[model samples]
Target: MAIVTTIRRDAVTLPAAELGPDNPLPPLRPLDEMHRIEDRDKDDLPRDMARQIGYEPLRSLLPARVRDGYGRERAPRELDALVIENDRLRATVLPGLGGRVASLFHKPTGRELLYRNPVFQPACFALNGAWFSGGIEWNIGATGHTTLSCSPLHAARVTAPDGGEMLRLWEWERLRDLPFQVDLWLPEGSDFLYVGVRIRNPHDRPVPLYWWSNIAVPEECRVLAPAEEAYHFGYERRLRRVPVPSYDGIDRTYPAHGVHPADYFYEVPDGRRRWIAALDEDGEGLVQTSTDVLRGRKLFVWGTGTGGRRWQRWLTEPGTGGYCEIQAGLARTQLEHVRLEAESDVAWLEAYGPLSAEREGEWPGVVRAAEERLEACLPRERVEDAYAAWRPCADTEPDEVLAVGSGWGALEVLRTGDKLPGTPFEEVTLGDAQVPWLELLRSGSFPEPRRVGPPGETLVAPHWRDMLETAPARPLTEYHLGVAQWHAGDRAQAVRSWERALPLAPSQWPLLRCLAVADQEAGHHERAADRYAEAFDDLCRERRDDGETWTSVTAALGREALDALLAVGRTEDARSVWYRLHPVTRERGRFRLTEARLLLAEGDREAARAVFDDGFEVADLREGAGAIDELWARITDEPLPAHYDFRMRPAM
Candidate 1:
């Protein structure tokens, strides 16, 4: 049967909890998770590896806001999806959900190659929070999942290298302020799907670049990659070189062999063709390979442990099957960031399809068979040749725009007058968030908010910061300038800018919160607490039209204030903030956990225990976080309940 590939608009209705409005608060915390690399066998690492690790550590998420407003209460919501299909396969992509390839179906085998998430449950997994599991997720920002994890992407239909219509998703990543696009196409009647990714550094200065294409396959599969050794990074916060296929006296190829969550970053030799595969017992499954530019491949296993299983359940529905992730990145490890030269861009072509291998064959032999079979099925040259064919067409203007993402990209393009031919950030895509920045770009003046409320989103890129520094000194300008200064590592100047902005600010909460963060960073806990309290008070006093949404923001701010208050031994103040939260907000699992913490801090152990007795699930429970179990153990020297035990580390 002859096949013709096509793209169409679609929707998937899942029991999804909506991602409520992002917290207007700027992310002031320095990311310390990457710095926790254990000292075990530290001498084995490169001479300057640890020293270089300090470079490009995520300082703050200034332009992006934290997305913690989601709750556990899910309803059937229809998510906008884009579908691309041909004779042998069908792929469903959620453009609104970070352009996640939500499902890939193999027609001949009647199998789903990717772990299609049964539900869309936003968790605190992404960099800016609110990430869902499963499918192929593109991580473009530093070390963590991209801030766009639960956000939308601009999508359009473009002419493929093979003359078929391909789906392209593009966005301006605010973290590094780079524009990237992913072009996905399947040749007619071919089992393999080709993904061409390009990330451009539009500025004259060099920028740190990070990109990882994460593919989730069922846990029943045995993962394989051509590497004699792999770097094992665990929740123990250590990276150690371990022998591949025989780590810890077991064939670590299978995801089910372990009892703790971990990452096995395959040390694929310099000359090797980069690939990773996960095959079932019958040795038939998906294999992903890319051109040499993407040098790294990794297998992430959420092992058969309590915490891992709980996380699997939390991501989707409990009854659904669990899965593991096989990833490819530009750097050897996710912890590292590669440098993109000024005005240069990196492009790569990736191929995803099915492969068959000897099911019961020995360690290296089965992997070798899979490699040989893959070569016979779809040669590396074919992928390379496809990449060559797609290069010129990459700039082919979209014939039709299917979905619109944030206006930030359009704003950037307008400011810089970047002629990004193929991936156009059209003026029509600009919307509310980009309004003030647009005004700033059009006229030399940055407009202040018309009402006394939380400030809109902030942009801290060097260009925007330069503009803010030169703009007229108003509260909004000063506040934004302070943020840009802090992002630029001018700590003292940032503090001074906020101090100048606070008193005359229309709404004082934003500036006060920034000051609170600064004070906390400087080890002035009492001063931080005082400022947090003031910020929370000012927010509560405001009467706004966006009552429920404002309440959500207040709840988020209240949590931050409560933590600072607790740090200074102000339990009563923390209690006051907790009680001030709306009933709906207070009922959330996150707030319930906070309430329990406040109770414990107030010396009411039983009260905290009772809060736990009413079992609740923190929808945004962080990866490797076991706070519930710790709090439970504190109240009573009891074995942690199975449902509550979310520790991903070794039992030792």
Candidate 2:
């Protein structure tokens, strides 16, 4: 059995001989709100400076410390005395060792030591000076002299040779405590060492301390958090949707880590958290930080392009590489649900001898022993307790009609096992803007709405498609009729339903859009082109009145519709429709670029250049610019090797 200790308060005071000037230090604050690092705004420098520096825009106006005639960025000056120190511990001070050592301490040391040096840190204890080049600071230090109580928390107490709650400072009895005061007396050739921290809590009052340390990484490193899905967001712009898929374990190189061309947002709902650990094949161990505790109330992760820390050793090559910082904490906006309990806190943490640190044998054994001790200290039930208890979004009564938001509704119902109420998709309310209502319905949490009537007779084709006789207020009815007719191979009837919808609901884009597809399927290619052109015109006119245009939907689908028009040799119609897309949008150039290729096929090289140039000026469309340039090269009679084998990338 482990040593049994008692709880106490107002215990015997330290002897006059042992009490130093720095003894009886100030108490540590609770770590309840420590995860608010993101809430603090970074200093804003001039815009010109920001553009000039690209991303590392923070001006280093603080005077550099001149050390031995060389200027060095300022950081903690002493560490050996201000913290637990060891020769092996000294090796980890290189500003990036926290990624290696992520664990908790299990037991408290019982003895205090009288110091000869009287400093917490050794002179050589500072880690490698500069690593993260993106204006983020990464440094560690210990105070040279500060009073540290044996036990700041009164949860447990130890009795020793001196008396109750008093720690003996004498040398060790045998092999233990080898590093503190007697490294020279150890057996020859033995490198093993032990440092101790004496702790006692004699008071009945609870002890708390907000213990935290940070590991920074380069601003460019990609961060991946486990979410049901992900969306890219540029902080400077209103959020623009980008095409990134949830990581499916099918591709190797295009794995979650490599797909990041821009910064992304990973949405972890309330009562859930994500662990975004970095992985570098280059020696730099992953930079893992959390905004809040994983398995806690709420956890968010962010990686800004501006400034961060880097690990030199983790570089792919000797002098070139990127850094990834994983910040573990709660989110601010869209995450007000996450909060900390008033009294709960992280009492102690250990950071050293990284998970990958390889020693002959004893190192791992020591770590295992330390972990086992920590596991034994906490009760099994509370081992994984979150920073705050989970709570439902709103109050509920038995059998009350309730509609859960699509994205998180399923999870909420799953946990509570509440009988969910049904709503028409059009009637459903979704609080979150990130996920669509259709997606939530498809995720298996909600019941699909059944139309009021069923078993209607299918309409037959021809008869001049009499369905166009119906009025437009019945778009839902016509839409259903159109789908049924299409499945029945009555293309004419489907086209009539679309034609009826366009006249009744002249502004509805979907009706004309469907008619275009119906026209193509019915072998009326010319008619299809006309319908697409009409729909594109409606969308452009609607945007003038409503500031919100269907950019995401149209930007993605319009190019597809135009490509179909071109496939049937209707290039003129394709060009007219392509010209309507906003030049600044992400999909602006794809259709026009497609047209350029079509012009090149017709031997019109100069016309294709003018068309490509119009849409290629947008910076976001640069991805498609390469394809246009290649086609231009081929059209201009530039000699290029045929049968080019682009480096293959495997993807699911």
Give a tens-digit lDDT track for model 2, residues 449-562: 243211122222221123322422265446545644554456687678757756665355656666776666567877777777776666666644222234434553365557
Name the top TM-score candidate. Answer: 1
Per-candidate RMSD, Å: 1.7, 25.1
Worst 10 residues of 2 by lDDT: 175-184
Which lDDT tens digits does candidate 1 get at residues 350-397?
999988887565767877887888899899899899999998888999
The 10 consecutive residues of candidate 1 with the worst lDDT sum are 30-39
Clash count per candidate: 0, 36
lDDT of 1: 0.86
lDDT of 2 at 150: 13
lDDT of each: 0.86, 0.29
